[model samples]
Target: MNFDLPLADISTDIWDTKYRYRDGDVIRDASLEDTWQRVARALAAVEAGQEGVWAARFHEVLANFRFLPGGRIQAGAGTRHRTTLFNCFVMGTIEDSLDGIFSALKEGALTMQAGGGVGYDFSTLRPRGARADASDTIASGPVSFMHIWDSMCATLISTGARRGAMMATLRCDHPDILEFVEAKRDPAVLRHFNLSVLVSDAFMVALDQDADWPLSFPPGRTVGNVRARALWERIMRANYDSAEPGVIFIDRVNRLNNLGYEETISATNPCGEIPLPPYGACDLGSINLTRFVRAPFTPDATLDLDGIAATASVAVRMLDNVYELAHFPVPRQREVARRSRRLGLGITGLGDALAMLGLRYGSDASLDAACAAMAAICHAAYRASAELARERGPFPAYRAESYLAGEFVRGLPEDIRTAIAAHGIRNSHLTAIAPAGTISLLANNISSGLEPIYAYRYQRNVRRPDGGLTEYAVEDYAWRLYRSLHGDAPLPPGFVSATEIPPDQHLQMQAALQAHVDNSISKTINVPADMAFSGFETIYRNAYALGLKGCTTYRPGAGRGQVMTADQQPPAKPCCELPGAD
Candidate 1:
């Protein structure tokens, strides 16, 4: 890979403003190379011996943006920022009481203060108008409490703290779910939260049967019932109109979870890439696929499978080192991270790589290429973790028999599985596909994880120190690279934008990759504004049928159109915002 390549203007700006470490008018990272070196040094310090050897290897993987770590890791690692290396956490379950709620809120505040996004499952709270057993007071319900959290996040952002990103999930069976589904209808409410409904297998069955579904609480308290199909339509309509709340197939998420036997998951990190149990946390990184492409815009184009495998191996080790170097916001979060040692390693530049290889984004050939690339990364990461376990010890929570029996593990290559059985794996779950928005931008505006190019060129608003927006022109990395090579030439058929691809193709791309991902994925199925309601609903139905853990979609000129329009401009947040992201 060419490490001497110059960064695009936007990439340079992103690095200088968001990632470069500085102290009291002194810049710690004088250049992009310095930033990579700083992070490499910090992570490699965790190695027992060969710190110098590992630092060089880590730096090599990071150079030329071949591997992009999560924004939190890029900014906080080797810095005096007093922040977490982990990007996000599923906070401990809300306790369903005033004290419990406030305590959880404070924990969230602290975690955010430490530069981590938070997720919460609000299903435990009683329904609105329900009387508390102990105090006999009318409960304000979960949505009401979410307002407090929303305000808190806004307050943090106001103070120039890390950009506030949060996910709030409510169970479909919750009596107050109706209100939760409509919470974002006003467009001005809960601006800080990304909401999702926890759809259970039972709920899908009810919808399939067109039967009445009970809205109930714990201990068999039946609040009321509604027509299942009607409720399902409401959810689809809410998303069709407002672009949220997304749907999480909660049953599938838990059942397919590698650690399902040990924990129950109710919420996901801000973008839904990782569905974590209470107090669960994970760090993230991506393999830039464009770096592995052997040829460009020619019949000889091919992916360097071996190179991808090698990078993935090094990336796993680097992320594992983060566990030793990071500071967790809470004791319980640290405990969970140490026990699981979860890492999210995915791919970026997928769209560009596909186009560079002369393949369409959603075609069968592209799907095959995607599966091949993801498989190499996934298997390589597992093998590396197993080797690390042999060198050090496995994660404290690893149980050889149960872990191997997991649905995802059972499908791994026989050799990888055999290795895990012999030497326990260092990480419970190794692969997840994040939105990778900010880091992808920092990597010269490469295509994000498993997503097509959002646009070839668009205006991006960068927030200034004075709280104003500065508009800058941004171009897709592959487009610029191609233009530089073949000036004024028309793009190949493979070059397509997010909206240019069919909605089913977007879902298909995600589904194809999901088979290899042990953790959930964060992908937005982009639908044209003219797409029919029935067609829109099929995307979710198909996602469930395809066995995806969750689904999020974005429709231009939808209810959020007031904020996100159809002029090809990216969303104020294209995906999950990274810590310190604009």
Candidate 2:
């Protein structure tokens, strides 16, 4: 747990501004080590008997940046703030009645205020123009109510200093399904929400057969019918123009869920990871994969499997402690947290780690590595959770017979499965790959979660003290390591960037990891801007075929803001200048 690694200034700056804990006007935690210590101490305090021992263990993994909890845990853990440790929650089903809908809205606000993202399944609400029994008025529909939630989220900045994040999901069979899919066509609408079409198996079947699809509401009601393929085309066309309203294979997600017997997963967190039942929250963290690579661009490069397993075990414990330490904003959320005790322990820097080992991302070799790495993590996580159950007891909602029969649990190693069956596991779901964008940036620009390096190098804007902007060339971790060793020589064949990889490779990689991950993944298949609509459609179908729970693709173009650029631009003055700056 040596805290002597040379951290980049940019990485330090990101932590300082975005994650480091502060008190009023005083800078309580000045350095990354200090912040880690503060968080470790705070989380360790929840340990029943041996706080100091567990605090030291937590600091061991945290000091070297090997294990990173979500941003909520980083900023709020030690600050004694009235914020929740969980990153996001799927709110309880919204009732169709006017009073029930508004009540859910109020609960969403409270959750957002406490710095937690929220997701809702709007299919429960009746379609537009549906009858209101007591009021004798037509219902305005779920989309209209979503607008209210959007406005509320826009106004409430979470405790982490970011605007609230939301996910609005609608079932494909809903009467207003078409309207819901096209709602985000206007960029101004649902600005604060990420929309997803919950594609049921029946819709896919109808789509494949080129048959008519029924759109219905309450009690087997069929309000309209449309050509399934044609409706799917509209969805693709809209996404081609604007990058939103991702597709989630809802039926597949539920079918594979470990808790499927007792819970139904209707929606996911904002980033499309961790599909959860109502009031379910994801207590998330990631293991820095780059830290486990034994050699850089060498013929004998190898991954430290033991290191990965050990870190994952500690990470699971830390994240489980998060459930105990978390402060839920709503009573139902608290109830759900206590019942499910879900934890999303994923990996970051996967692409960089692959590159460092002289393996091209999306190649068969890299895919094998990803599968092995993720398997080790999942196995270790379940083992640790079982051990925890022996000491702290299983989650309240855990049912051994049903849980062991789950697709994911059944696939686990025999030893791990036996242990779980004997003692049960602390958490229902153990793994998810989140879009760890900011955390990866904080970790010295390592490649994001399960995503290929966007570019080898890109210019970044940094504000100077004198009110001017300075441009720094940020290099991907493996690229930086290559340059340091090879000195401006062309990148090796292993250094494959995101744009160079094909869409299918992305799906292959995701499917490989998804096998080991009990929950869904938050990965973007970066496709070329000029990719054909037919090809884009194929990507999602292929994703479903590959057993993926969800598919999100990012094609850089107009309407979709630029995320990465290779071209250099002139440095300009800062947006807001100090009064007396020269």
Candidate 3:
């Protein structure tokens, strides 16, 4: 376990400040390897009588950054903190009455306090202007209640040095659907929440047929009606203007769920990766795809599919163990997690992996490669889970006959399906593509989950001691590899950035991976600044047509903060240099 660890300064800094384990004021772990060992040892302890053997295997996966757990896991595992290892959870159904609403709110606050993100389906609450029999007054609606959850989330800081994240979803047919869609128009509203419109199959069908859609509340009350396409356009406009509310194909998510017969899913974890039932938690991890690339920027470059499969198998076992060892915020959450044993085992550095193999992201070759790689990961994960089921026992909620009949399970390879049928499966759901934002950075700036490189190189501004800014150049993983192989040469055609690709291509890539993913995939279609409204709307429609569970797009706008500037010609220098120059 002792060796020379070649660490990047940026990666080291991120680990030191964010993930490394500490007790009181004492830093117990000093290096990235130390953190890896800590996590490996903690996760392995769940394996009865074989902690050492599994700990060594887990350490091997973590050593070279081949596997990454979510931030909550990285920070809470192997520590004394009373936080949950799961990163996110969908709260149980919120009742329409005042008492029920506040009760759910309390649950959300408690979950957040335990370093877990939460999602709530606000559509359960009655619409605005509805009658309240107990108070004999008007009901305040779902949006108002969402505001209270937002404030609660804002006040509770997560274990990893940030406020908790939340997702608020509303059904499209709700009477206050229009208000929910427009709630984020003011930039200040719902600051801590990510809004998503649960577009049912009925709504999409109505839009396709140019029919009027009813706006209704509970107990079969129709409050109003509007053109379905018109409401769809409003959603498009709001997203175009502010990028607040994303869309989820609720019908599709439920239809394809492996546990659809047992549970009803309304909302998803914060990033829309795992759409879960009430009190259900998201146990997530990612296999670093870039690490499995055998060769880089050469004719012989190839992806090591077997390597990926092995890593994914180990990752599934580690994540499943996480649920056993970690503490839950409440008794109900623990019960839900143990019954189903849901885990999201995904891949990161996909874009970088594609580039290393000399494949352009979004191209046909890249899509095929992504599909093949994801298929291998999913198959291996399922097999591993089945093996675990045989050794220990299937999850409490496992329904062998009903589970095998699920849409996703039925689509798996014959061998995998047979294995599951014979041995049962430990985790209800496996394989989701998470954003992996910080973990990607920690992994030496590899391209994030299924996203093309934003920029190969960019100048970051750093404040100097004298209060002036200094420019520091940052290079992406693929860019660095390409430069090492062919110095100063122009980037190959494979070096396609996010903005260079079309929006449709992004959806295609997502759909390709989504086919094998049992849960959802977290992907953002990056549209250009000058893209037309019509073009933007097509992305969502295409996503639905492609059978994706959800769609999210990012278009740089007025309020959107700039992260990195693309490599293009700079504007002319200022008319006169500032007085603080050398």
Candidate 4:
């Protein structure tokens, strides 16, 4: 399988040599030309299918940045500016209190209508019996407030196009923990929200030792007297059945968080990967990890490391420019953006990567290859960032060797050193790993963010704008493998599920690669609801044990949140008048 690879015309040759890439080295291409065409084809499919809303948002979504400092801004008509996502933390609350529960409803209605995602750590609102200091009136707690917010989302269509993405996070110790645990089961509860329960490292350890875990909230409340193992049991039970609530390792998110000391992060953006401060919309983009291929995969399966580093140089350039290409909204985004022009350069098609090299997705051989590939990419990305610092000058925070050291004076690339001494580089932090939601959906139907195939092929029925609907069958790599092997064959039973894969396997896969990432990894564990909640304690331990920044898990009925399922419909939006009229 080995063949000669030309050093010249490398960008083009690398991908062309993919056929020859050995089992140890392979990357999905990051070239704009091919990716652009693929994006166009997707848009065309949506348009041809008369998916106006989806099509309309295409340009916007591509330009949208969901990392921090610069978030969202309006797109000028005459010219296109790189766009960023600006999320409002507490959109409809605080401003209106005791009596005006409906005050913030309109904000939610309108924002979600514009296709903007919203999230808030409802735990701040006083619990069921607590009083609002401002109005002297009793409060109904976070869950009641969620009902109003959910109703708004139900009423408004995102940008009158796609559905809005929202998140509601609650502290595990909240007195209403029991109620939040099973809120989603009603099928009549929050219909437009995704829920996650925040857990701490202290609590996780209790579960393992069979110690009493508190079900108490109110910072000073008595820690409930139940065995930690028992509480974990309830959590695992819910995950097995409904996949309602997800668990968030709050303490983990804060540890080593570059910005952890600056602010407390309670919620994550739409896809439980990128954690953000309330009202913080982060600007984000990715470098196609496939660009590092240096040579052909000979029958022997060797990889080229030098070429990977050089192309990583090009990727750093593209991501750095993304800051300038994008238009940021609000002063905070612009300010923070100035401090660290951050970007997430994550990978995709990992399974495809392993498959191309003839490696199994779950085996030890593939795991080793995956980890090595990640290290190479990480080293290259950092080196490239340093190179840019030399020429244009380092990021404001770019230190010599210390992460927080800001002055960029010594030990820079020769070419960049002069440029840095001349015209400082435009961005700060240059890397992150995002889940790659739409991008993954459009390209090859690969499992994203290190996720295995949930189902070989599952039908996703989307409610269209006209009140009608369309169904999409997402096919996984395994199913495609079966189809290609026997185009018309259908004789097997007991097929493998991503779930069929072992638990530790998932952790090992995420951990092996996470070490090399600057920000964090956005992978989720799919535990069956029937499985015990107690199982989660181990999953949490393994992540920290593995040295990951953070981890999230899906369990049924984990919190009090709203979501759109077949059975429940969105609530009608409220109609109110001008300032004083009503």
Candidate 5:
């Protein structure tokens, strides 16, 4: 008998369909009987691994993990483990190397050590000047000081035992913009951070008007270039060439910020998907992106509705349960979670999803389908989570009249709403699309977010449990789909890499897919180390043109003094043995 389990389940390597979530069915469609069955199957697998790291591996930072109806999750159990890498609040950091400029690497490190990924404004550190973000008489410039924190991140891992991830944001008004743009020109900066320049709405207006724009940092930094368009050109060139120093429209960044009422968001979690609070960690989880795409398009190939619904329903349950298994460090974090029951049920293997359905990510049809698909996922996740709330109670902040209120509350069944008013919810916000890292791996190498493959078969270098380097060959699922479209041999697209594909499609593809996701996506636009820095503007505008919540990219020069490449990177890595190491 084939005794298989979920991808991460060690019991069997085979794909376990027993607990499979059927797509195309909404919470309304899924009978409670059908929902409960899925829940039981998954929890059984999880309970089976309770004794070892398997349980811990799935544990999140702050929320407790519990299976909801249809195998969904209910966060805020033991630890309040939340989702990471999904779109959340703006996460900002004040590096304190400057003469009291910000919290030196110490506080930032402390925050990350406690389970937070950070975002930094290197522009404030001063352009490689005598004073960094601080007023200290003599100090290094922003870029130099960034290295300090980078080193700390490299040296001091997080409480989860994972290397801290961060985003460095420099405004367009800063001097040394060129230097900042080229900081990751080398593969050096890839170690501890993701980098993006904060562009303003003015910059886009200027680009459109063909006018010159000023670049300043704290009123003291100088504008290093003329012909704003020229600079934009250079940036785009760099993006196309190097793909680093991704651009973040500071104006838009604030435009979407709902918490600006309570707090200003400046930075984001590691992957730049979720902007977070100071010392904030993104508590993320996701569904399989491919699961939503049902194909065999009517003559032209549209999405398959049934498959999408089934996947969405099941994904909701799986992510809801994730909260129960997570382990967080502080009570403050738990309280943060109680306010909102947000779960990032994003898709992984979009490349695979699209591939399975025979669609190109950059194409119009695929893009349109993507939007509908995401909208559907968002819709499905919220509905299921609301149903979960019916039994589990609505998240604490679920005031039907409030701004933080979930969109689902109004659409929920009246009976469920009544249950919520009486019982309250088990989670707060239930739909966010995170960078399904481990989930993607376990799901069999799907393209991340709306991204295509990065390489076809590059040797991924990774650290092992034994402190040794291990190389895992990556299988680009996109390539498989590309090949499958032409043939029907009986095998799914194996794996394809992005390196061999057209680089221009990268940004366009992201812009196209990001339209439907309410939360931001975590995708690193890759450029070769030698790529030029002139093409960044076009890329930046795409986000604007596309109205993305936010965007980030990795350039060769941006990752200076960092780890740039992947080596069989695990879901999370080995950490310093804590008080108790099994």
Candidate 6:
């Protein structure tokens, strides 16, 4: 069967370079149809006598860019490569001892070598200048050891393997927290790690009251103290000068976790979407919202809610099947994965989808539309998982009482909750909005994840299989589609790029979706370089107030490099050093 081919050059480039199946010199995926069929057949093989029936369903969802699996699944499924199907993993904690640190480092290396990104909570390490009780030796803090891991990641990437993405998280109260926050000030240091402050509720309250906050470690050992507001100001100033350490509401993450009863989430998979316990991995896929928009750019524009629901259901099954077929890098990862089958089923092309509906993103009307669409997808996904549980079985970690008591679950529709109580649920957690940057490009450069369009047109640099960079002229999906329809007509007011949206509205959009998302959403609140430092700090404060799980922002001239430049901006040579980027 002939499926619609990729409409843009970048779409074809991403597929061929990132997702296409190849056996050395031989290309197995001759076309995108072959790629989709290959993945569908592989995943459906685990369906127990319903392979043909389910394969067709999977293919239909995957075709036409309607649903996109994580890059690992698309590239490794049904192939001979011994790589994981999951995109990322939160590695087991880094033990403070020498042996412990190296063991965790080895695990990260293996995981990355097998084509999966990794996240690590470095708060376990002792503070710099702290004397070890047993060894009577001075200890280097988490930030110091991070350099070792950074070197390891750089070495792996230099070896011509897949690009490495990692997230390193430090508790806001850790004695070395200040150093961790400042470690990335130099562009050349820790290039492979995306750092985040694991901000607890206590710290926020302390900041509110202008209290002196103790920097404690090793359980109740106060190594130092600083004014809470002062520390926060330092964080904000660091980010304002150089967009390094993003903020994560760590306490809220655990509180809202569907598996909170069984696990403590201190770190997230790279890109801050899947907050995972040690050894936990995320099986991710995204339903393309653009494909579900009906009569786009017309007075009758509306999201095809039924279509999204159907596609989301099938996407869950496909992600669940990934567990059966995946080649986990470590046995512990596989063990944790089987116990709690986590699926990050989210949406891509949201910006374009909103624009297609003639609703400006971050507007009140757009928030309602986004909420309604996410609600449909979220509930539909839950219902699908429950049905799978009855057909197969609940995930090993599922405890009906504890699961039902979760904040996110208790808020679900009664019928869906009832379904879960009666028949269990296959996946422990079901929704996470990822930075689908690369996959969105594969889908004709639709606005990525929940972000507004970065620009109507830009030059995107894509890395070739041989490690060289190739630049492509890319245009927004909605922009191109609208041009096709109206022949260079003036864009409506609904079309707004990322820079044009206010930081608060960006937070609002994320907060609106976070209501339905169990796993966190990966959104970068783009702010202008000239924004006041005080105003910059308020964005993080607002994120906490608005109950967002985390927040990241990018300024044009920030320390971090860019992958693309708008037509009006100065040209930028593409850089792949971004860790949180998809």
Best by lDDT: 6
**Candidates 1 and 4: which is better by lDDT?**
1
Q: Write the per-residue lDDT of candidate 6 for residues 1-582, one digit (tens) a residue.
A: 111233798888889888899998999999989999999999999988889999999999998889989889998999999888999799998888999999999999999999899999999999999898889999988888999999998899889888888999999989888899899899879888898999999999999999999989975888789999989988887888889899999999999999999899999998999999999998888889999888888889899999999999999999999999999998999999899999998988999999999999889999998888889889999999999999999999999999999999999999999999999999999998998888899888899988899899998787776778888888999888888778778998879999999988898999999998999899999998899888888899999999999999887778988878898998875566553334
lDDT tens readout by residue for model 3, 81-134: 887888879998998888899999999888888778888999998888989888
For each candidate in turn, the TM-score is 0.96, 0.94, 0.93, 0.68, 0.66, 0.98
Highest TM-score against the true fold, candidate: 6
Q: Candidate 2 residues 174-257, lDDT tens each?
A: 988878878877866787788899998988999999999888888378888899998898778777778777899999999999
Model 1 reaches what TM-score against the true structure? Answer: 0.96
Report lDDT per candidate.
0.87, 0.84, 0.83, 0.51, 0.50, 0.90
Stretches of model 6 off by over 4 angstroms after superposition: 1-6, 579-582
Point out the worst 10-residue segment of candidate 1 by lDDT: 573-582
Ranking by TM-score: 6, 1, 2, 3, 4, 5
Better of 1 and 6 by lDDT: 6
Clashes of each: 1, 0, 0, 49, 129, 0
Better structure of 2 and 5 per lDDT: 2
lDDT of 5 by residue, 1-582 (tens): 111112323111112221223332422214323333333343335544443332333322111111111111311222223322122322334544443444445556655564455666666555555453234465556777677777788676432334466678777777767777777666545456667777778877888898877766555555454677877776665555555667766666555543333445556555666655553433455545554444432134445555555556555655555445544344444455445545555555566666556665556655666666666666665556666766566655555444334333445456555555555555544444455443344344455555665554444434432335444555554444444454445433323345433445666666655544444566655555555444544455665777665565555443232211344433333222111000
> Which has the better TM-score: candidate 1, or candidate 5?
1
Write down the TM-score for model 6: 0.98
